[model samples]
Target: MTEFIPPGTCFLDLPSPFPMKRGGALHGARVAYETWGVLNASRDNAILIVTGLSPDAHAASNAGNREPGWWEPMLGPGKPIDSDRWFVICVNSLGSCKGSTGPASINPQTGHLYRLDFPDLSVEDGADAAAHVVRELGIERLACIIGNSMGGMTALAFLLRHPGLARSHINISGAARALPFSIAIRSLQREAIRLDPNWNHGQYDDERYPESGMRMARKLGVITYRSALEWDGRFGRVRLDSDRAEDDPFGLEFEVESYLEGHARRFVRRYDPNCYLYLSRSMDWFDVGEYCADRAGNPGDTDTRAGLAAIHVEKALAIGVQTDILFPLQQQEEIADGLRAGGAQSEFLPLPSPQGHDAFLVDIARFGPAVAGFLERL
Candidate 1:
């Protein structure tokens, strides 16, 4: 019998010699996760929640605190996820800066931080690791898997890699593969970190961190995650009281610039530059079709339809924002279409919001109903 993991934050040590996709491995791999609600007698009431970049396993309020989590608006007793009816499990990604094992963790072999030495990670690796957690928890199948952005990618990977493990999937603003535009933007973000003098090729001291590069990268990310419409409506070239004449050339006059800077400042303190590099690269390299092709005796094929057809879920839902330039509505539509081609029931819901790629985070009113309806049916 599998061990029953209690509700709250905890760690699951993966079996020894965890092999990675890029031919690298970790000896003492561990995954951090959090759980809510009780597992039913049938062990089929579990819901796996895969988060986007930055969020940890803390998906909602628990015994530790009553404070709202990043997804608090949609997860609660009577909320969309309805913790009272389902057991929700959220795991930190393998290469994250959170409590999970990542670049920030000590290398068991070297007695030092993994830093750049951490093995390359892929979305499939994250999915496999999370699967181990589910198995450890004694769950034979998941009622549904819900993911957003990077989490959405992970959800697809999970379904592809572990056939029939989940009964349903909800992908929110995720893509089968990264587009050139996104790849280009992320490459620039990585460049900013690499060019930082203090970066020292990923060997900088903890005290003298690469703040400038990280801040710039974060600023760029904030711009891409939001829409021009939102900026115009929210900031509208409004000047902050602290704006200085000498800073005009640097574009600090607008309140929007100040907002980005404030967000960057807060992010730099919490995230590690090395972790960002690894995870960003991983997303760029992910291609669900590649995995699907390998499963179908064509290791080098690029048939997207063939790949999506491998999923064995009862139903799937893809949600997208109208202004989501990062992943876009077309990508979500493609997911729905691909799933249908693969012989699964699928639905596509494109929402109109100025919030862009981050709409799912900001516009809960639009997402809560769509997600709740899907889950309730399952």
Candidate 2:
């Protein structure tokens, strides 16, 4: 499985023998990243954007690649991210197949694909990789670090691991830790992939790819990415054509089912199942509470709260959609409350968005002003 390197994506060679958070190391590895705007003379205007699972480094259009990015609506000149005012850098997560070294990447020593042989990945490892990218670019500290969904977890780890490196943060639809429900959902997704006979223990090729497993996994994910409200509103219980339904009594009965099937099919071949497995498992293994074992001052505090309080950003904003089942609203509230306890000016905003965890990417009209106002005040 070849990694998907986006056009115009930039690469940063990681330090040789780059140690993984768990055991094992990569002799030669690289991170994929893309930047918008320019760092000012003072270099205090640099901002970093870490992504959720599956997103590439391209966050928006640039001279090198005119194609609009996944977050094209939110980032650009005068947009919410306001590239003209700040130098924005978005990095593909380290364990991702999007131009970053991951399971899909070839092993340097063996000259064979890493596949399942890749070292165990942790959210902290991604944080460390992102930090290296910023430092390599000559930015001593970032104005802000923005994260979405899994990237939210990475951002939290980034802050805790490297205190004072980013002055502020905007955590959108992110969480301090993976909730049990999220873990359960991801477990099912992974199970779907592994159970596919075509997976072949992560050794399948194009001719024998795990399409069924990948489709099931992606469909399950897509079902969770948005809310039931959005589903009902977008595609009620509308049935497909009677002729089509008659052809296969058990297949694609409703509009929603068709939507999911179409979406899953589109994604199955675009992303490597092995990479998906690695990234999904990493989220399950991450727990911010692990860092709070020794913090004694906050009596009766949960580890999640105590750990979040240990971080020291000067200012922060944690946003969550009201309908987000994955990465619920409470997590964002906890982030704000905990950051406030640590003396950062923090606030949590819960929007009445029906898009669920993916609302930050859509519903820009509602999210745009909130982000712009925060950045403007900075």
Give the candidate number with the greatest TM-score. 2
Worst ten-residue run, lDDT, model 1? 1-10
lDDT measured at residue 326 in model 1 versus the true structure, 0 to 100: 84
The sequence of per-residue lDDT tens digits that candidate 1 reaches over residues 1-378 is 011222456899988799998879987989989878888999999999998888878878877546667788888788899889999898988888777788888899999889889998898889999999999999989999999999988998999888888989999999888888899999999999999998888987768788899999999999989999988999997888974777467667778888999999989868888888999998998887888777778887877666777777889999999899889889899889888887789999999978999898889999999999999888
Clashes of 2: 0
Let me know the TM-score candidate 2 reaches against the reference structure.
Answer: 0.97
Task: Give the clash count for each candidate.
Answer: 0, 0
* Per-residue lDDT of model 2, residues 261-353, tens digit only: 999988999899999999999998777777675356444444888789899999999999999998999999999998898889999999999
Write down the lDDT of every candidate, Cα atoms only.
0.87, 0.91
